[model samples]
Target: MDDQRVSILERIGLEKPLVQAGMGGVSRHLLAAAVSEAGGLGTIAVPGAAAIASELAAARSMTSKPVAVNLLLPFARRSWFEAAAAADVVVTFWGTPKRRVPGIWLHQCGSVDEAHAARAAGADGVIVQGVEAGGHVRGTEPALELLERVKAALPDYPMFLAGGIATRTDVENAVASGADAAVAGTRFLLSDECVAHPEYKQRLLSANSTILTELFGFGWPAPHRVVANEATASQAGPSGEIPFINKLINRASAAGARFTPESVQRRAVAHQSPTSRMLTPHAPSEDLPRRFVEAGPLYAGETVARIDKLLSAEKIVTSLVG
Candidate 1:
């Protein structure tokens, strides 16, 4: 690695150039700490300031290694940034380039243009996400293809490649293609530390194909890739419009957040917020809500077809690095 790249990695305490993607709800304390402990960058996904602080603290308690926090810029409130600034690294996704963060900040981008924007906005690095990525995809092209394009455009910039990465060879290929690191979500989702419901993990294990749809577009109206399920099948014809009532609910939530006390908002953002309930993984003790299983988004990447067994987060990181 170049000195610049090495410095960037060191800033985030990455001994191995592998990142456990910050999958909302799924990438909580246990999973993040495991990856960090094993030498890769582990990221916790949370939206509000309090949740970010608490999760970071939890991860810190497990490992002295550096940890990162991910916040979806579109959903982040001012309080989120305040809390995230204390983390070793802050990663933002799904929004235009903006640097309201302190410390080393990285932005996940979908295209060359977005990568340039991120660089111009003073991001320490950029994660180029391809269409094949799980959850909310940002790029229209394949992961490697997008990585090559962005690398060509910004040859000296520190970049991470995300999408369809499942094995050690995938990580090697990403590094050979000019990526400083590789980010994996679907592979980590199957890790023992992930909080994904047993049923959800089983569905991923059995799924052989994925589809992009706007079915779970209540709060965030964007195309997300997932295994085909009853929820996806029910949406006949074009993606139906988000219900007016749901729109009202989303608006009300945002409005309510502004007036709500910081302590209350912190609690609400993770549990009661519509976005959290819709996207975050439910507790393992909760029975797999059939309605959610049928309709809620089961985000996975194209690599889902290749993963079959669950492993420890540390094992997953070792396998990818080896």
Candidate 2:
């Protein structure tokens, strides 16, 4: 890597150019702190302002290293910006690029156009997410393929590659392909520090394939990649319109609530509702029903097939970039 790339990593206090993707509710204080302390950038997914603030404080208490917070722009309320701004690095995804904080801002882009827009909007960096990524995918192409296109378009911009990254070779390839860093989500979700339920983790260990579907798009409506399970088997197909009832519940969840701690908590636990399939298996007290292991969205990247063991977050970071 060149000086510019080194500086980008240094600016964010990342000794290793690896970032743990902010998997909503799953990537909490323990996971984030563990990654940061292990030399990579750790990120906490923010559902709302209150959760962001609380998570940041908790992560800070665990490690003095710098940490990041991610906000899903499409579902984020305006007040969430305040809490997001407090983090060392703020990352936004799934919407238009806008500077809501004075800190280093990075936007996740699904296409070259979105990458350009993020750069034009003054983003310090951009994460290129491809179809192989878990959770809500942004691009239809493969991760490295999209990374190449965006890098050619914005040669000088800081870029990170996300999706299907699980091993040391994956990080090496990302850096060699002109990425300043590599971001991994599914791999981290299986880490010891991650809060994903044991059953969910077991499923990932055995899963060999992932399907992209919009079935759990009740509130988000975006295509997400997940391991095949009962929830996905019930879906008619890979693509379709979100159900009317889901849209209603999604709107109701966001209706007129300020981004306070209480309101944020409600939205974070929205999966607990019987009607929604977006279960937060990371939340121990959510009282997720037994069927959730097979019925809820078990987000995973294409790399899930290669991951078989649950390692510590620190061990995972070291294995990737040591």
Candidate 3:
């Protein structure tokens, strides 16, 4: 193994080549801190400009180990990146890759081409995301295949594997396929430390399948994965595609969100249209009502089928590395 490629894990101060994916809203301080304490890189998903500092501070107080932050670039403003400077590393998702954070930065890419773009953009590494990833569908293929292509193109670059990660074998496969670490979101989302709604967890527990759709794309018009729910069922045709009229509306909403003032967005979130009522790019935290959660996107990966039980954040890290 090349020192440059393998040393990325060491550079990140990971005891095990495992990373907890920063599930927005779901992976907060307690969960991120616990994973870091367990000897892996724990990541706090970017909460907001107002909360990033406090969230990182809270995680720092809990664990002396390194903690990272995940940012969805579409909604992240320049201030958000500036506010995230405290994290050991900043992991960004979607949109063009940029070096906003001064420290180590990584971008999640859906394809080999995107990985190339990240490298050219001076990203420290890339998280190769497969379409099977929960929360969002980026890559059109499975995780390993995407990793393979990325590895082939940039064999010496630091890389992390996301999607299709639920077992020890999956972690092993990721490393064997040239990933420096295995990034797991769905597994960690089920951890006791995660603040995901109890009802959301329960819904995912019995979920054996997931569907990729744009039903939840009000503020962000990207394809996402979610368990079957009334929200999806209502919009999906027999083939699971949304109708033309709704697609136009979703596209308009996505465009409008770009120019939509934050205050208006907040009000919209507080009083969402019935179509995406109680939904955000972030997963539903415990405070969301069960009724809304049931009708909203149940973001999860295909690995969800393999996870039938919830574990502590530490135990989850141990189980994946073991």
Candidate 4:
């Protein structure tokens, strides 16, 4: 590895250039601790301040290795950032670039402009998330394609490649393409450490396809890629295009977010708001209601088609870094 890559790995206390992406609700102490213990950087994703603090503590207790915390800008509360301060690294996504944690802070970006803005904001690194990535996508370019663009714009900057990574070759290719590390979400989402519902995991085990859609926009109406479900089937046409009314809802929701208070946004997360009918970023967890399983978004990356089995977090780490 080059000095930039080596420096980032050393700073984050990682042995391999791999990160198990922080997933909302799905990623927790067990998964984070396991990934870190297995020599890859692990992250405790957002739930709440108490949950973050508790998960961070539990993860630390289980593994002396470094563990990171993820805070989604749209859903993050001040308390969430405050609680994440105890983590080794704080990873932020979406919104304007800003440093919320004291330790190594990395911002996940979708474009070169976002990467440059993150650098100006004093981020220690950036995870370049491509549109092919699971969850809420922010960039239009392919992961490696954008990785190179970001590299040319900011040489020596620590960059991790996200999206389109599901195998060892993908990891190696990312580093060869200038990424300091490879960040995988869909692969890890299928891991045993992840807390996704068994039905959800089973669904992805055989998943041969995925679609990008704006139909899931309820709490946070953003473009997200997910496997087709009853909800998507009912609304999206055979071409996967949502009806005119659905598109209007997404546009209105995106516009409303600008004026909506953070408190109200947080309330919507609990399914207690006027827009509770829409979907947030939450993946299906244990007993999230059959209604959710049938209709809720089952976020997966384009690479989900290749992941056929569940492995322990440690094994997943070893596979990615192979």
Candidate 5:
């Protein structure tokens, strides 16, 4: 690895600066440990702290390096505070920060106020996830603009920039724009260590760009970027408001197997506004593409267009440092 990469790792209190962003189901033990073993900060995105202890135990079994875990606020399905206290770092997205935990709280921010609020919430660091990001966007500001504002406000705060980060130039630009480090999702999703399904990875590597769509579940109108596909391109026009979409998704979820074949078979996938890029799942099996017909939407980024191969965590980290 490059010397600069080593320095970045030290600065972030890790062995490498190449910290992998949280990706729900995708950030499994293998991927997280692989990054950590390679000297970067590897994190497990636990919707809550429910399995924090078990996950941590498993992570320890994989590598003794520092590991972080993500706690999702928007989902609100689980609470991981107690379990997270045992981790080296804890990242929070979409939720108000609470008491100071042992691990770093990487609060995801889109607006200036949220940054300050995260600081007040005892977050050790903050990640500015711009609207261009694949999974969920918190702000309308371009990623660079948001990073600048965040740096001006929280000069001392450790700021990790996400959304649309795909290339080596992206990393260098982020550092010039005042970001201490860059967090990548789509790029890492294609790694060999990544547990994403094979077909999903192939589709991303084969495509020129991924779509940012609006297939929202729960009350969260989370924007997901994916590859252009049948579900996304077929959603011809706006189905309804956020509420309407939520209700429909809720009905579909509740109906389970009882849902009408039409609803279950409803092939229209919601694509992000202003773009046709569709989100592709990271499944290991070829059957996943068919399974996703009713399965959840794939959350990815525009940078995925640049992902073309499966590199090891070490190669990915070292290349970024150079």
Candidate 6:
């Protein structure tokens, strides 16, 4: 693509219009820096910034490129906001735009109405993520319609389209629809740099249609698009109670204890019924159980089906740009 054709990409100091959407726990140091180094926009979720300054340092050490840190609204701890205030860029997710940061604030919006609201609330930019996204399901309108409405309502704002964006056609379609850029999560999730567990990537790559569970927390009612794992398959409807194993995981995590696979399995076995056998050997960390139990449906997008192999950040950027 010509330089002029990707004006917004240049404005963001990127060679491509693709952005690696921040995936909270999964969007850590290595992944974020690699994405930026590869000439695409990279965003880091700073949930662990307060606790693990080393992670932030690792990201900084990896690249000098512009990196945005995600700020989740209504977090039990406000450290993420503080981290955002100090970041090169800030993205607000699952939160009301009441807090103002010095850096650019890319407020998460599901519809044109929300985009306008975010603009009015002082967001520097608005990321228009549609319902087809992997991690969190937001908005009822399809991506194309929502982008049209957003472009019509906020002509001056730099609007970015997200959700189920993976292939070159998706990028072309986003630009044709007046989007300044396109954000993709599931595509990046399958990359070699993504910190997601091996099993997580494998599951995402092999699954046809992952389950969308509405049980996760962090305020909004976003759905998690997870592959049908033992944990996800066992999840009940919205009314189903959170198991004691998950409760213990939450409790222990809040107290500053690191969760390892063994510890989590022990806690899970103790809390869950004898029939529960969701724990598997290949799982990388104990956090998987917590993510499945507490943060299920493991938010994913429809585009995950297209991801066949893990890719390097540079290769990923080139493919996205093409």
Error of 2 at 207 (Å): 0.2
Q: Tens digits of per-residue lDDT for model 5 on 164-245? A: 7777788778877777678888778778877676766777788785555454432344555656544445552343122344
Taking all chains together, the TM-score of candidate 4 against the true structure is 0.92
**Estimated TM-score for each candidate:** 0.87, 0.88, 0.95, 0.92, 0.78, 0.79
Candidate lDDT scores, in order, read 0.80, 0.82, 0.83, 0.84, 0.65, 0.66
**Per-residue lDDT of model 4, residues 1-322, tens digit only:** 7887889889888888889898888899999999999999998885678989999999999999989999878667788899999998899998898987789999999999999999999999999999899988998988888888999999989999999999999999998998888999999999998988888888889889998877677546678888877767777656557767766666667655545665775555456221334555557776465456556678899999999999999999888885
Using TM-score as the yardstick, the better of models 2 and 4 is 4
lDDT of 3 by residue, 29-118 (tens): 999999999998899985467778889999999999989999887778777888798888899989899789888899999999899999
Error of 4 at 156 (Å): 1.4
**Top lDDT model:** 4
Deviating ranges (above 4 Å) for candidate 4:
250-277
What's the lDDT for residue 150 in model 6? 86
Q: Could you give candidate 1's per-residue lDDT for residues 46-143 as a string of tens digits?
A: 65678889999999999999898998876788888888888888999988879988799999999999999999999999999999998888999999
Q: Candidate 1's error at 205, in angstroms? A: 0.5
lDDT of 6 by residue, 129-199 (tens): 87678776666677878888888888767778888688888888997888877888888878888777666
In model 2, which regions exceed 4 Å deviation? 238-287
Q: Candidates sorted by lDDT, descending order?
A: 4, 3, 2, 1, 6, 5
Instruction: Judge candidate 5 at residue 312 and give its lDDT.
Output: 81
Q: lDDT score, residue 80, model 2?
A: 85
Alpha-carbon deviation at 89 in model 2, angstroms: 0.5
Q: What is the lDDT of candidate 2?
A: 0.82
Candidate 4: worst-modelled 10 consecutive residues by lDDT: 272-281
- Model 1 segments beyond 4 Å from truth? 236-290
The whole-model C-alpha lDDT of candidate 6 against the native structure comes to 0.66
After superposition, which runs of candidate 3 have C-alpha atoms over 4 Å from their true positions? 256-263, 272-280
Give the runs in model 6 whose Cα sits over 4 Å from its true position. 1-11, 51-53, 217-221, 237-296
In Å, residue 66's CA in model 3 sits off its true spot by 0.8
Ranking by TM-score: 3, 4, 2, 1, 6, 5
Error of 5 at 142 (Å): 2.1
